[model samples]
Each structure stands twice: as C-alpha cells, then as structure tokens.
Target: MKIVTWNINGIRTFKSGIKKILDSFEADIICVQETKVTRDLLEESTAIVDGYNSYFSFSRGRSGYSGVATYCKDRATPFLAEEGLTGLLITHEEAVGCYGDQLEFSSEELLALDNEGRAVITQHHFTGADAPQTLSVINVYCPRADPDKPERKQYKLQFYKLLQSRAEAILRSGSHVIVLGDVNTSHRPIDHCDPEDVDNFEDNPARKWLDHFLSGALENGDTEDQFGNISQKSASGGKFVDSFRHFHPKRSDAFTCWSTMTGARQTNYGTRIDYIFSNRFLVENVFSGVDIMPEVEGSDHCPVWAQLSCTLLPSPKFPPLCTRHMPEFIGRQLKLSGFFVKVSEKQNILKGYKESLPGSQEAGEIRENMNPVVQGNNIIKKRPADKEAETKAHKAKKSKLTKTETKPQNNLLAFFKPKQTQLNPPSPELNPDPGSESSACLTNAILADDTHCNSTQTKSSDVALDTCVSVVTETKNQDKQDKETAPVEMCRKGPCSSFWKEVLRGPPQPPLCKSHNEPCVLRTVKKAGPNLGRQFFVCARPQGHASNPQARCNFFTWVDKGK
Candidate 1:
C-alpha cells in the first residue's frame, strides 16, 4: 500500500478538476493539508472522487482557511475516521477513543487547539502472517508560527504538545500510529537550504521540540560552544521515526516546501518541513521504502509517500466511508434532469389513467396480455375484429348516456348536496333580518349564477330557502380557500437542501435551473480572474459526470454581471 501526504495549499484551486489529478497520483491513501475550504463550500468533484472514500475536517472558526482531507481508495478504505486530536471532534462511532489523561490542558484549550481544522485520523487493519494488526494514520497540517505574533508561537507549541499526547495515547491503545503532514519546522541545518544565514538557528523552540520528538536514532546536531561544552537535550529518546530521513539521512538539499513568492523552488532553496513519521518497528518491518515526489507541481510542497509491505485488511462489519455508501452522494449521483422528468401515469396501477381511456383495455385484460398463455402451435393474440367490436360498443354506450344526460351539471352538484327532508313554508311573521350575516349569505347564494335548488322542494318562502342555501355556500368557500393557501412541496433531498431552504425564505429566489427546476446555489469567485470575489449562481445538485442522472447542469449566471 502506498500512502502519500501533501499540503495542497488550497484544495478549491483544483475545484472540479481535482478528481483527475487525484486519480493520476494512484496512491492507496492520500492525505492533503491546507484545503482552505469550509463544509459549505465543498464541491461535488472534491467530496465524491470516483474511486476514493474521503473524510474531511473544516475550520469551525473561519471560512476558506486551514482544513485537511484524506482520500483512500475503495480497496484501502479505513474502518474508522475521526477529526481533530481532541476527543471532542470524534464524529464517527468507530474511533480511536482512548484519549488518555489530558489533565494538563483544560476542555477549552482542547477545543481551541482543534478549532482550526488541522487533523484527521483514520484507522485500518494491516494483515500479515499473524493476527491482523491495527494502524492509525493521523494526518495533520501544523500551525505556522509568525515571528510578529508572540501568541501564535505559543499556540503552535501547544498544538505540538497536544499532538504528541494524542499519538502516545493511540500507541497505548494497541494501534501502531503513523503521523504525517507539514510540520512547519525544519529539525536541523541539513533539512533547511539556508540554515547558515540565520542567527542562533539551533535555539528555535520548534526545532528543539523536534529534536526530542523524533526517535533517538537521528542525531541531535548541537554545536559546541566556545567553552567546549555540549548543550544538554530536552529528552533522552522519542516515540516516532522520521521515515524520509531514516532512508536518506545524509542526502543533501532534500527539501519538501518552497516560498512561491520568491520563486525559491526554481533554485532548490527551501526547507524540508513536510514529513511522514512512523513507529520505529513499522519503519523496520512494514514500510519497504519512503521517498518524495519533487516532479509533481500543483503546490509549493510536493508529496511524500511510503510503500508498505503489509496488505490492508477489509472489515465488512464497519464498511469504509465510500462516496457510494455515503448519505450525501447516494442517489445524488444522477443529473438534475433525472429528477424532474415527468413519469407516466401508466407506471402506477393505482393511477389507472390509461385504463380509464375510451376503448382502452380493462385492468384484467392488460394483466392477461402481460402474462399470455401459450397455445400448442399458434401464439395467442388479441383479435383485431374483437377490438373493433369493443370500440363500436363503447361509442354506442357513450351516445346513449349523452342522450339520457339532460342535466349533467345538476347531477354532479347533487352528489355533493346533503340529503334533507322537505320543510313547510316559513311563517310570515318569522322574517329574517336582511342585514344579518346569514341573510347576506342567503342573498349572495340565491343571486349567484352557479346556485341551484332541487325540484322536489316545495315553493318555499324566501326565509326557508335562505337557511338551506347559506350552509352550502360556506362549505364551498372554505374548500376553495384551503386549496389556494396550501404550500407547495419543495425538493428536500440533497447536501444543499438546508442551504436552499434558508436562501429561498428571505430574499427573492435565484432563477430556477433549466434542467432540474431547482433554485441555483450562490457562490463567490476566489480564483485569479477578472471576476475575483464576484458572486454567482450555479445548479445546487451534486457534481458528477454529465451522464449521471443527479449531477448538476452547466447553468451559469453572475449575480451582478455588470459589476
């Protein structure tokens, strides 16, 4: 199994094109840092790669900032995936839950450390001759400490301490751990291109921490002072081994990151801040080789991969989080057209619209045709003569009904009228007030063109007729009002469903998509173009191949094109 790690800078830079580049890498598991996207801004192409199962962690405090993602091939998918070093961020039931003794840091501290969306942990089983062994891969994008910000320096150091605690906790939980990503700190002068120019480089706090964090096999190159005394190290030994340096310790200028603004990468003037650290036992036994791919050119930091000799054990009990099985991607793999296309009434037996048509076959006849009985020699078919005879009989019956139907409208109205006994004429003295509500209702119903009374009723006085007509008028008006006020059912199935609901409520809705008739989702332009930071709208459906039934259509419209 080949496991690769890279800080892609900004994942949305690829957007819909990321999938093709991901497929080109051909790694079993690829962990990317600096995704710079929130959960809301996630695109279909990035979330649901064709053959990979992905887990993502987004910054809760910021948008288009620090984030990380892990993509595992379908065959190499993990049984469990968790986000953040803190136990607070473990969303999945299957997790590396043994977060032993973090009494040093308060609950608020733990939450603050993980709020930047830095880490994603995935657990897999690696099988060999013996019983299957479990391994945890913690992918992290460590915080970069700015020299100007003293508080940031403390935060970065705290992150490292929290990270170390989590790794040790996982180790104690019986799972071998592989911690990898951009450490953002060069451990020694050999790892940095221009280490000699910097004053007091060895005194850097992060480098000092790395010296003690890595296994004792790597030498701590402490310079001798003028008094000929060696500086004492912080710790005697460390828990993890740097995989790349383990294989090529003496190899010079083996940098993994560069400054894009200075074009330092062109001159090979950079530092090796990215790493893949594993247990010494795994480095010796399971990992066959570890190397960097400097040729790949999407980000300033290139990818570092390790080849493992062990096979990835599959777990049916806990299936991997593949796009096919995930709630957001399932059924949404189709294009927008697939959802809006009209379905035929004949498709449902309960509708029976086709069977109700004149000269159409009855329900039993249609069922008989569906399952035909075979004769000895000749195949059975509905005779043309019999069909013509049935059509003629249908026409004759229709004509006879038409002749008998003297008052078809009254007959239909009578079905809705309640049965009532004949009433005697109202007394002359018992007269209703013309200005009362019931009197007004009676007047309106009698004057209305659609109102009618049965011939069986006596030629009653106006007062008696007024009571009967008022009840019918109110019932009809109530039914009419209900039909007019009922809300239309909106599409409620998709990743963007909740977003669309909120978008639809307040402002005027965006123009409906031509293909799906769905209100397009709003987006902003962040790339280097003429329309940078410009807002626009596109289909809200999940992205997929054009052939897919639920994939979004190519509907593009700028929110303010003139601007």
Candidate 2:
C-alpha cells in the first residue's frame, strides 16, 4: 500500500498533475494539503475525482482557506472520517490564546476544534497479511508561522500539541496510526536553506516546538531523559520518522519545497518540510522507500511519496473528473501576454461552473472544456507544457560555461560565449494578423524580401536580438491596431493600492531585487511605433534583479482593450 502526501497548494489548480501522479504511482491513498476547496465546489461534484472515494474537509470560517483531503482506494473503504477531533472544543478567547487552550473535553465543556479544515483522519479496517488491522490515517496540513500573522504561530504550536495528544489517545486504544502531511516546520538547521538567516534560537518557535514534541513524551507516564527531553518517539512508541531524512540521513542540499520564483527551483534552493510519519509497527513492517519527486510540476512544493510494503487493491477502471481552476503554472511566468490564454480559459471555466449541481455522485470522466484564444491568424494551444525542460537546458548551458569560474564569467563578453550556429528564422505565417489583411500582406512581403527570413540563416547577437524584439514589437503594434482592444485607463493608471500591488506583481516575479531591495513590480509603458500607440506591461525590475539580463522579468503584455 503506497501512500503519498503533497501540499498540492490548490488541488484544482494542478488537477492535471494529480492525474499524472495517479497514473504513475497507482498509490492506494493520496493525501493532499492546502486543497483550498470550499463546500460549494465539494458539494457540486466539481472537485470529485471518480476512481477513489474522496473525503474533503473544508474551512468553516472562510470560503477558501486551508483544507485537507484523503483519497482512499475504492476497495479499502474508510471506516470513519473524524473531521473534528472528538472531545476537543477549540476556540479563541482574549485571555486564553488565539488557538485556544486545551481543557478536559468534559460534559460541561465541548471539544470544538478549529473547523477551518486543517486536518482530517480517515480510519480504515482491512484484513492485513498477518491479521485484521485497522489504521487511522491522519492527513494534516499544519499552519505555517507566517510573519504577517504572528498569532498563527501560536495556532500552529497548539495544533502540533493537539495532534500529538490525538495520536497518543488513538494508540492507547490499540489502533495502528499513520500521521503524515506538511508539518510546516523545519525540524533542524539541516532541514532549511540557511540556518544562520533564521531568527535567534531562543525566539524561534519552530525549533522549540520540535524539541518539545520530539525530545520527551508529552504524556504523563513516559519517562524523561537526563536532559528532560522526550525521545523523538511518539507516545504510541512509533518513532516519528522523517522518512526522507531517515533514508537520506546525512544528505544535504536536498529539499522538498522551493520558492515560487523561477531560479529558486533551478538552483535547488529549498527546504524539507513535508513528511510521512507512522508508528513503529507500520514503519518497520510496511515501509519500503521514500521518494521526493521534484520533477512534478504544478505546485511550489513537490510531492513526497512513501512506498508501503503491502499489496494494493486493483484501482478503478476509470478515474473521475478533477475540479478545474486557473492553472498555478500560469503564475510562474512574468509576461502579461502569457496571461491571456489562461485568463481566458479561467473565465470560461468560471462561466461553465454555473450549471446545476449533479444530482448524484455518479462515475464519469471530466474532460476539461478550455477554448483557445485566436490572435490574428496564429493559433496557439490552449494548454501549454510547464517548459521546465527548456528552462533547465538553458541553465545547464550557463552552468557548463561558468564551470570553475567566478561571477565575472557570467558576462556575455567574458572568456566564454555560447556557441553560434546556423538556424532558421521564425516563419512569416507565425503572425497571421487575422484582423488586418493589409498587415498580413505587408508582413509576408517583408519576409519574402529579407534574406534572413527567405532562407535558413545564422544570426549574430545584435542581428538576432534586434530581429526578435522587432517581431514582438511589430506583433504588438498590429494587435493594438486590431479590433481587439484594451482599456486605456487601466494601462495609464499604474498600480498604487495594496490590491493592485499584488495584482501587478508578475508571476515568477523577478528573482533578484530592485536597487532599494524592493522586489520588482510589473508596470505598463507606452509604445511608439507605426501602429496604435498602445500601452504594454514590462518588468520594472532593477539592473540587479539578474546578473546578466537587463530586466529580470522579461515579461510583456498588451492592455486588454476588449471586454
């Protein structure tokens, strides 16, 4: 039985990645964190993926917030789904704390934990190879200690403490348990990118949380070591195993989660936070291997999987339709032009969602209905690949040239240069100019006369870059002159408010920072050409954003003129 845990960030955003993983791993159960799904979507059958029996816990406080879900194989039905930790009433009071204090779950006081859909435990009774066994599979997405929200840190600590208590109680009842998901806390310095950059040891709650949770038993009966630390063993005697760390014990520079920025993943600057933990019996008997799949695209955090050495039941014949949302990969690009295709598709999906909810949870495959936008005569595919391979290849070329060299070698006029080769220029038909027949004819004539476009050609740095920029510039001019138009007011009024600041922050925001250490912002600029004097967006990144590129985020987007 293979179980996988991934903070998919938003399940709908990378529904394709989920399908890809399900196809590959054939996991018996897949647990996801930060599902960010609301009750409306869940009840509407939009989020239901057909094959596995899925159970979702949604945030009760807000519409879309922290949510956790566990999908179990059809054959291995869950015995019970404990959404609210029974007998634990949790609420925020002024004196007690924001996350609430733990008192006896007695008759007078109720156990109402935060119903923000943070954790969900699905119990399954199965006939094991040895004997009949029942496993309480708990999937938790622990709260992060966000700097903006200090109280959340306290909430996280409380959640961690409650989780341990819950695990202890479950174990005391003689039931096997496997608690796994994003703990959202780096256990040690080795688990993070740079330990020195972190807050002081005395002030860091994460370190304190780990020490208290791992060192000594929280329960009364357990013995404390000489230093009064609880061994990393859970109250139920399942030594909390960081499966990845356990296997790659001394491994460094290995991370499961990376920053959303582009170079972060490429450079492999990341932290190991997501984990799979289980009791002694489950660990020793069922544990086979742990794999961190960094290659998987869709979420900022990669999926962490563990192989349980047991026979998995045959999967269902047809998988169900996963919920559709704006692709997260779309946010990875800084270009405004990059947003058009996805933004269009997202609007369509949102419109299509108005259909009446399905009467029953019948089995059916959901073929996402995403229509592509036609720009002039150019027809682009609706769905684009992550393009990670291309990015990696480019980086690899830079790496090869920079070998054993200092930072100065990164300059184009340095000791090394990219090997020049003959290449065919882009075809004239690449820009059909569907709106203007005259524009198309003129472009074709230019291509016919130009030697570069007339035949397969090799281009010098100046000629190539200039031609590329000209093509883009001309294309925008043609688009601006076309019937498809953008709101002039939107472009003229640059982002000012906090809302606009976040909205204008381009995807894959400039990796480096501006002169004042401020992150670069995407801003609009007016173009001067033979065509319409339309405004387009560009990365207002400073020179320092990238070591080489003048603009860190070479993003471009014409203002939307059309409704």
Candidate 3:
C-alpha cells in the first residue's frame, strides 16, 4: 500500500477540469492539506473520484480556509476515521478512544485548535506477521506563526504539542501512527536552503519541539550520538520517524515548499517543511521506500509518499463514508423531470387520487364528455350523436362567415379609402340655365365658406355673384396645391423619425487592448480620487496574479482621451 501527502493549497484548484489529478499519483491513499473548503461549499465533483472513497474535515470557525481531505482507493478503505486531533470531534463508533492528557492547556485552547479543521485521522487495519495491526494516518495542515501576529507563535507551538500528544496516544492504543502534511517548520539546518539566513535556527520553539518529539529526548544532544550521527533504530524506540530522512538522512537541497512571490521555485531555493513521518517499526519492517517529489507543480509544497510491502486489507465491519453514499449522488432523490414525465406507476397514483377526492364524480363526468377515455391501450372517441351535433354547429358557423364576406360594401368603407388627385380640376357640373348655374355657384360657395361670399351687400348682385364664383375657383386651386405638396412633406419627416432600432444601436466599437488584442471594456471610476465618476477603457479580462496568463493586462485609457 502506497500513501501520498500533499498540500493542494485550495480544493478549488481541482475545479478547472483537473479533478482527476489525484488519480495520477497511483497511491492507495492520498492526503491533501489546506483545502480551504467548508461543508456548505462542498461539491459532488470534488468529493467523488472514479475509484476512490474520500473523507473531508472542514473548518467550523471559517469558510474557504484550512481544511483537509483523504482519498483512499476503494479496495483500501479505512476501518475507522475521525476528525480533529483533540478527539472531541469524533463519534463514539470511530473514535480512537485516546486523547492523552490536556491538563496543561485550557478547554478554550483545545477547542480553538480543532475548530480550524487542521487534522483528519484514518485507521487502516492490516495483517502483519503473526497478528492484525492498525495504522492511523493523521493528515494535518499545521498553523503558521505570523510575524505580524505575535500571539500566533504560541498558538503554533500549542498545535504542535496537541498533535504530538494525539500521535503518542494512538501508538499507546496499539495502532501505528503516520503523521504527514505541511508541518510549517523546517526541523534542521539541512531542511532549509539558507541556514545562515535564519538566526538561532535551533532555538526556534517549533523546531526544538519536533526534535524532542521524534527522539523522545529532553535535550538536543541526546537525539544524535557522540559522533554527531543520527541513530537508525529510533523508530522501534516508541518515537516517530521522519520518513524522508529515514531513507536519505543527509540529502541536501531536497526542498518541498518555496516562496511563490519571490519566484524562488525557479532557482529551487526553498525549505523542506512538508514531511511524511511514521513510526520507526513501520519504516524498519512494513515500509519498503519513502521519498519526496519536487517535480509536481500545482502548489508551492510538493508531494511526499511512502510505500508498504504488503497489500491493504479491507474493513470487515463498516462501509467507508465515500461520495457514493452522499445524497447528491445516491440517485434516490426526486428530480424535476419526474413531475413533467410519467415514471413507474406515478400516473396511475395521480389518477386514483383525483377519483378518491370529494365531488370527483361530477368532475370525472365532465372530463369524459370533453376528452377521450382510455380503455386498455386504445382511446375511445366521443359518442356518434355528439359528433353529429358538433359537425352541424361547425357548418352553420362556416356559412355565416361566408355570407359576411360576400355582403355589399358600406358607405363607411369608402370614407376611409384614399382618394386620387387630378392635375387639373374638372369644371363644375350644373344646369346650363343662368339662374340654375347661379344657384349652384351660391351652394358651392356656402359649403366652401369663402370670405369673399361674406362681402358687403351694397355691390351689384351680378358683381357679388362673380366674386363668389372667383372665390370658389381660388379654393379649388388651393386644395390642388396642398395635395401636390403632401408627399414632399412626408418624405422630409421620414429621415428624422425616432426609430427604436436606431436608439438600440448604441455606441461604436471600443479600442482593443495592446497586450491581448481584445476589445477593451468601459468602466466608470468609483474611487474618491481626481478621476472619480470619470469613464475609462480597461482590459476586458478578470483581475488575477501578474504571472497568470488569463489575468487582465495593464492596458488602460481615459474615455475623453483616445489611446
């Protein structure tokens, strides 16, 4: 059985179609640290892998920070699993039943340590030589001592102490313990790239604690022999063994983590803070090999793994808590499609429900009259008499529509129709007798209301009649002139009409960014500065790290100033 440990930095790193990356390791069990995922944010794709069963411990105090997960191959599922090293988070069934002594720390301190989701422990049962053995794998992402926060240094030390107590307790319970993850401290001068750069390297509390914990020695000198060489039999002496050093104790520059901001990984300048530490008995007997993989590049910390000589044994008691058991993937829940489509006997059940309700007989009768009835697989049509009656009503409606269309046109129809214009007005049609023509002219002038018809009565009657006739002729000429100019006026207004299509056309294309040759996006300044409320164009891509290829470029220009 092979087990690998890695700090994936954040579980979301697997979201970009790289979830299968875990399978590439080919290890029986894979432990990840700094998952930065809360229980609410968990996803099916992240939790479920093709051939793996996973268990996750999420931060109870925060979201998107400090979580751990373990993925074991289906065949190598653990017999027991629990969260937190303090033993407070475990259920009675899978609990390790040991937490050692906690009298040195207050209750609040113990709660604070586990609330951050720092550890996940899984016990795999295996057979060795004459008897069955249990190996407890403790995956942890230890807290870092922030220089800005002086209190974190003490917290960090306390975390390390709690971790040591838990591992020792598991050992006391007859289970071999394997503690692995980002320890957040380089134990020796050889673990760091620049030993001289760090003042009083051995004086660091975390480093001193780790040394004493591994050797069970109160003093640093007791860990090494008189010749300054580390002993090889420390694993069988009831103490933890650093797996990488157990194989290559003097290996230098074998760093697992680097500073991303300084580009230190390019020069291979880093420290070996990530480790896979196990019991000396396992390293000496059941373990075949152990090493670090610095070539892997998804995170700042690389992967370290250890292999066992024997195959893993499956648990005979309980099933693994894998993604297959999760509610989202269990395939038992109702879906939206179930409501729209008939499945199984649901349609029959619904029909029975309708029939069982009060006043359902009347509703069923109405339905039978309007809709076809289902008899076995065939649909029964409406009664013959009912069909005949329906056909007669349709024919009467069609005949009424035909009669309405064939009727004579009404005078109102002609009133709304457009009238044609004539270039020359036709002479007025009237009787040839002078008296009749005079009367016709007076009638036409009265309808036109020509101001000349309202002239003073002192003038001769013949002269007044001539004035009315002249006024009527001038009105005809005026009407013809207005009709001839109407089309020209309409054409002039057409070009200035406020069309919706024109309004929606919006602004023209913006200038392209120089870096990616992509169109820039317009943005308004929101900060309280000289350019507040001013518009500008910037690269369209989202903001990201400077080294990220998909991150936005530094192309920017004010809207008023063209680039």
Candidate 4:
C-alpha cells in the first residue's frame, strides 16, 4: 500500500495539482491539508475523482478556509470522529469557564472551541494477508504567524502540546496510524535555508517545541536521542527507523520548505517543515520515501509519498455464492457501442451509391446511342465504267433542278425575315382612365346630402360616409399595431447588470460569517489582462448597521424591489 501526505493549500483551486500527484504516486490512501473547502463545496468540488471515497473536515470560517480531507482508493468504510481532538467544538466559554458550566453543553457548544480550525481523522479497514487491519489517517494544518502579541509564543507551545497529546491518544488506540502533515517547524539547522538569520535556538521555535514534547523518558522502552540518530520500537517489537538519516547520515542538513519569492526549493534553500510518520508494528516492509518536485506554478510546498507492504487480513464475509454467474449486461452494451466506422470507409460507401444513381446511367446511355454510323454519313460505292458515267450525269441533272427551285424560295424567305419592335402596345385598361370626369360626377351624385333628397339618395349617402369613417379608423388602428409590434433591441447595459442578473437567477442566498453575522465574500488578487480590470465590491449596504468589512459573503440574494 502507498500512502501520501500533501498540503494542497486550497483543494478547489489545487484539484489539478492533487490530480497530478495522485496520478504519479497512485497512493492507496492520501491525506491532504489546507483544503479550504466546506462540506457542501467538497461534494461538488471533488466529483472528478471517480473511484475514491473522501472524508473532509472544514473550518468554522464562513466557507473556504483552513480544512483537511482524506481519500482512500479502496472501497473501505470510513470512520470520522464525532468531534475530533482538534477542538472543533470546544467553545471559548467552555475553555475559560469551569468544567461544570460546560458539562451540560451540546455539540453546538463546541463551536466556541475551534481555534486554528484544522485537523481531521479517517479510519479505513484493510484486509491484509494476515488479519483484518484498520488504518487511522490524520491530516493537520497548524496556525501560522500568531496575532496575539504577548502570548503568541505561549499559544504556539500550547498548540503543539495539544497536537502531541492527540497523537499519543491515537497511538494508544492500538490501530495502525499514519500521522503526517505540515508540522510548521524546522527541526535542525539543516532544516532551513537561513539558519544564521536569527539566534540559532530562538529562531527555530517548532524544533524547541517538538523537542520538549519528546523530552521526557518513555516507559514503553522507547528512547529519544539527538538529531540524525533516533529509533522507535513498537509494542509489537517491530523497529521503525527514519529514512532521512539512513540516506544522508553525513549531510546533517536537508530541507523541505523553501522561499517561493526566490524559488529557493529548486536550489536547495528551504526547510523540512513537512513530515510523514508511521507506526512501526503495522509496516511489514518499507520500500522508499521521496519528495516530488515537479516544475509547476503555484504553491511553494512539495508533496511527499511512501510505499510499503503490510500484512493484511481477510474482511468479514456474510455469505458465499457462485461468482461466475454474474451478469455482463453493461459490459456487452459498452463493447457494442465501441464499434465505429472510419471516415475513409464511410466516404467509399457514399461514392459507391453515387456511381449507381439513375441519372448517371441515363447520361451514359444517351452518350452511347449518339455514336454516328460510318455507312450512313459516307458509304462506299461500287461502279461499272460506262453505266457509272451515265448515272453520274443523271444525278447531276436532278441536283441542278432541285437547287434552282430551292434558291428562289430561300431568297424570298430571307427578304421576309421579321424585324424586332422596340415599343410595346398599351393594354386596354390603360387606354381609358378609370377616374375620369364622368366617373367623378357619378360618384359625387351618389354621395350627395340625403335629408333634402329622395329615399335612395338618403340611404346611399349615409352608408358612404359611414364606410369612409370605418376605413380611416382601421388605418389608424393598423399604424398603432405596427408601432406596438416593433422588435426590441436588447442591450446588456454594463458588467454590473449582467453579474447581478446572474446572481439573482442562481442560488438565492449567500453564506454568512458566524462571528460577524455578515455575508462572506471571497477576495482574490490575480494577474491582469486586456479589457479586464481589477474587481472589488463593497457591501451593497456599506453604511448599513449590519455591514462588516472582514465578514465573508459567498452568497447573494436578489432584492426584487431594491429595498
């Protein structure tokens, strides 16, 4: 089984990085830190890794922040801590107040205890060659750059102590465990690039803290020695050794963390702040351990992985049946779908059809039938001398008579050839104007005032006026209809309009920051491009009573009335 530990920074943004690592290492179990994704985000974010089961613990911060996740390739049942020792639920009130005050608290009360907001443990049962084994995996991302002035050092110390205590508890559980992550500490002078930058002992705070944790003598027959010389024998009497000292016993100076600004890791100018520690008793054999340094943009940290063989046991079996009788329905369907025709072959099939068309055959037949017969155009003639001469004379006379008669007729016909006319005769309708004086007089008499005239005149005049008014009204109505039916030219207006429209159409709400009681908004600084300017948005209600600058708002709700 291969196991890997990497601090992926932000899992959503670092998915490609993690994918590349997973492809190369192919570790059975992977532990990641600094995932910076919530439980809801994790479901959508990691859907690409098809054959693996994942366990994640997100920080209490709005949505994306310090978090950890573990992935197991095998289909193993995962066991997550109800509330792990990371103090994920420990409230500030509970921590400061007496035990009695916090004794009656529910799970909600533990939220106040969350500090650095990292750490998660996932257990997977493995069937090894020997017995059914359980592997406990832990991922951690410690706090960096303390804020509190006077107690910063003390806080770091206390954090390390908590971590060590948790690690001890896991070890005592008698399960095979892999405790690996960014310890945020350099153990020796060789662990960092600039060891002389500050006072030697004071500069390496993490080293001092770890040393203090391992200082007291162990009663379990394990001993803590100086740097480059340390070994631990497990309760099962199996010896687990550190590989760094074995590979480079004389160097005394190997590092892992590097300065991103200077590309220091490439030149071996960094510290070894990350580690992968394993239990000795469970490991039957250790193959190798190495840090992967692929040339990639983003993130300063490198990934480390290990390969080992362990004695595995058989998993519990419920019942046994004939495995060979299983159905192959999906597999057969996929196999059939995989067959396809090549472009060249398809083109050939189309060409064959074109050659067999009715039009092609008809054209070919017409060309064949048009061939001229040699005998009809210029036939071979046999002749007797005397008779031939008489025959020729007779033919000449006949030809002459025919020409004489035909020539006169042809001349007459040529003389009578038709000449083209330029002007066209007018049609009968155009010859006489429809609206003449007679017609106009008749129309006027028909439409004259009716009250002083006969009965027919009265009725005709009334109908004519009514018809004219109706026509006019219809024309006005048509014009109004045309105007109302004109096409509207849609304009996007501006970036704000488009963005706000999308926000309104999408999820109706944003995540709220628990502490500030305001929405959480993600801020990003990135490289610039043409037609693209930097983006920054203040709270829509900046001066409102509930506004908080630091608070996060990942969701936005549309205010239909702009209230």
Scored by TM-score, the top model is 3
Worst 10 residues of 1 by lDDT: 222-231
State the C-alpha lDDT per candidate.
Answer: 0.75, 0.59, 0.76, 0.50
lDDT of 3 by residue, 1-563 (tens): 89999998998668765446877888999999999987667887788777777888878766688989998888888888788887766545656557887888887788778878889888888878987888899999999998868899999999999998889988988988899999999987888876764556766788778876774422322345531433343222438878787667667889999877445676667899999888778877888888889898878889998898877788654333445665667779777865564444545655653543222332344456445778999987664466778898999999999999999768977888988886555456432346764666667576855655545444575575776677567667777887899788777767544565566666546889999999988888877778889887888876544566676688988776432
Q: Write candidate 1's Cα lDDT for 1-563 as tens digits.
A: 88999999998556648778777777788999999987667776788777777888888777688999998887877888787888776435667676767899976678778888899988999886689999999999999997768999999999999888889889888889999999999876778876765546668889777867877543324223421211356344788888887777667788899877545676676889999999888887888888988888888899999999988975554333333455555665657765453345335642452323222224444445433456998666544458778998999999999888865555687788888763333334333577875565456565764356444556564455656475655656755665565433123334366776666555335889999999988878877768888888888775544555676688988885433
Q: Return whichever of 1 and 4 wins on lDDT.
A: 1
Worst 10 residues of 3 by lDDT: 227-236
Candidate 4's displacement at residue 52, Å, is 0.5
lDDT of 4 at 157: 58
lDDT of 2 by residue, 263-329 (tens): 4666566788888877656665778888788887678888888887665433222122112222321
Lowest-sum lDDT 10-residue window in model 4: 318-327
Candidates' TM-scores? 0.56, 0.50, 0.57, 0.45
- Lowest lDDT 10-mer window, candidate 2? 356-365
What TM value does model 1 have? 0.56
